[model samples]
Target: MRIGVFLVAAQFPGMDSGDVLRATVETIVAAERAGFDDAWIAEHHFMSYGVCPSATMLAGVALGRTERIRVGTAVSVLSNRHPVALAEEAAILHHTSGGRFVLGVGRGGPWLDLEVFGTGLERYERGFAESLDLLCAALTRPSVKAEGEFFRFREVPMSPEPPGLRPVVACTSAATASLAAERGLPMLLGLHIGDEEKAEMIGHYARACPKDVPAPGHVAAAVAQVADTTEQAVATLKARMPEWLRPGLAGYVPVDGRPRPATDVDAYVDRLCRIHPVGSPDHCAERLRRTVERTGLRHLILFVEGAGDPAATLENVARLGAEVLPLVRDL
Candidate 1:
């Protein structure tokens, strides 16, 4: 099983984005040394939260810094980028990571990006799906004419194309998962739902995935911090979580700009724990094992760093790779 971590690129008031950059690269190097499989850099904009903003640029950084430890966008919001740009950057990441790149596709925060890209929510939904379709076509198919509502192409072959057995495409939403399955794409789920929702979401994804997709539905289950001590993990998470990682913020924060995320940490945790995996390695591994038994997930993505001191956070990464991973790897 492949194990990866979430890099929020969380930035504090006085914090330098460069620090996160250094930490991220160092973490990937360490992950490679520790036998971890991949590093998933999340994208967020204008928030003090995970500040990657650009996955391909970071992928470039990762390529220059690490020997292995595949680097992938935890997801690149499809609604935010053009398919050509996506294909080009992914090819760059593929080259940078020695072909160890996974394309994490999603229709995330259509509200924020849609406006910037001169689109509406429904348009975002459609454009995101279509862009992913063209992206896959650009990557593998030798020649293609991708004409859709938001994007169109004719005889454009994205070269050095994902450079492999079709780059892994992990969809973020059920609708997007349907889009993926309809086109036989791999699925990557965000660990952001209740138990029933999680199960149902996976069900939809699996039902949508075609039997002919290169790999069986590739499911990635995301979870929050993994530590030796659950108590410590929770405390650290609350203290240091970036703005964007806050739970229910989207549901609460209206697009109309009404004040929201108005609740305190307790409320946030109550809602977030419903979606994220937070506990000691044993507890986390137990949950993961059960989920895999039920869903047969191909990868387990974790958010190893919390809102804590840098040293402690890195230590947590080391601990999870050294301690927690062994318990669940063979399960």
Candidate 2:
């Protein structure tokens, strides 16, 4: 399986945006030196939750700094930007990166994005689906005409034509999974859910995928921290990860659109660590092996930064490269 680092680029309290972004670039550079296959960056806006407001911009910075290791957006929210604009930028990025750019698209935070962009929430899913369609077409063909409920374009020529743009869709529900399958796009699953939930999501996608098309590649992401012992890792996470795992972090609604069991902060943290891959190098390797075996995943992206101090995070990355990665590189 391919191993990648997922950089959240979150600006913690007391840190400036410049510091956070510089740290993220350094992390990617470090990951490449540590023999990682890829570095994925997350996009967030108007919040310290993630300081990389534009993941595409950060992708450029990462690509400029590193070679061999692929760099991509963990996801560029489709609802926030115009499809034509995004396609144009992605096409250029794909060429500039020497075909190393992977455009991971998603429909995330309809409320915040829509409110900020002054779009209606009623068209959230439809607009995103349509935008994705337009983007896919633009990436492949030279000129295209699109007239959709959300975006309209006529005789648009895709300059600097994208070659082999392998877009990955980030899915959180059965509906989104089916959409990704219908488009024959690879998936980027998040670290939020449990094994049973993941199995169900994968099954749904498999069943819904068209038979004529090749099976889509599956990727799973998780928050990971490796130390000499499990206790050390847990303690580090417990002290430093509170800002990221708050109750409303999942958004206003449960991911599955159903009522969720009420839980306190400590319970939530416990559940998150349990669901995600968090432990010593040996233990993390075994857990990731089990996850890959169970899900038939092609790639695993670990969120190895932002959950702790810079020193601790860097130590985890080094240990991951030296101790954990060797154990599972061939798996």
Candidate 3:
């Protein structure tokens, strides 16, 4: 299986913007040294929740630093940018990186992203579909033509022929996953759902994909921490979980039905560990293997720097690279 790191440019309580950016690049370098196949960058804006506003720019920085490992955006929010500009930027990066650049696309989330970009949440999905259509046409065809509900464009041709780029979609729902299948694109699944939900989503994608066409290998990202013993891993989670589960963070809402308060550290840690791949090397390897078998995921993107605690996060990356990765290398 192909394995990689998903760089989450998370800003901890005391970290400045520069600190977050530096650490993100450092994580990419470390992942390359650790023998990761790729490093995917995420885009976030107008919040310390995630400081990186341009994942493509960060992907360029990572490409400049690492020679072997592939780099791509975990997702560049399509709803937030003009498709032409994004296609041009990504195509340039792809050319510059010798075709190692991947253009992962997604709809900007319903929260701060849309509000700050002056995009309406009501039309977000429609806009996303329209954007995806335009983006695909722009990246593949010599010229672009769109008369969709959300975007209207003339026959504007992209300069310098587009490369052979296979884009992936960051899918959070079965509908979007099916959309990926329809477009013959791969899907990137996050670790926010239960195992049953994951199974169902994967099954849906597999079924929706055409029988004559080869199914694009799907990727799944997980929050991970490994140590000598399960107890040690749990201890690290206990220490870092509170900060990671801070209130108002996206994707982390209810602490069992109510909004999570800052004090709900233990409960939050338990919840996170229950759904993520966290344990000793052997333990993690077995779980990951089962995940691959069950979900038919060919790539696993490990989020090693879960809490943004530099010391612990780096150690987790190192240990995962040294211990866990070798054990599960064949998976």
Measured against the true structure, the TM-scores of the candidates, in listed sequence, are 0.84, 0.92, 0.91
Candidate 2 to truth, TM: 0.92
Per-residue accuracy of model 1 over 1-331 as CA lDDT, tens digit each: 8788767566644567778767777767677676778888877765556657787678678767877677878777677677667777787777756677777766676456556666566656456667767777666666667667776656765576545434445554577667766776666666555446656766786677677665454646555666667776666666665443453143323344636535465666555544556678777677677767766665777766555446665777777777778888896
Q: Which is better, 1 or 2, measured by TM-score?
A: 2
The ten-residue window of minimal lDDT in model 2 covers: 247-256
Worst 10-residue lDDT window for candidate 1 reads 247-256
Off by over 4 Å in 3: 247-268
Which of 1 and 2 is ahead in lDDT? 2
lDDT of candidate 2 vs native?
0.79
Q: Which candidate is the best by TM-score?
A: 2
Every model: Cα RMSD to truth? 3.4, 3.0, 3.5
Comparing 2 with 3 on lDDT, the higher-scoring candidate is: 2
Best by lDDT: 2
Report, for every candidate in turn, its global Cα lDDT versus the true structure.
0.66, 0.79, 0.77
Q: Candidates sorted by TM-score, descending order?
A: 2, 3, 1
Predicted candidate 3 versus true structure: per-residue lDDT over 158-260, tens digit per residue: 8767665777899898889888888888888876665567778888988998887787887778878888877777777777656745631644332124443
Clashing pairs in 1: 8-50, 240-307
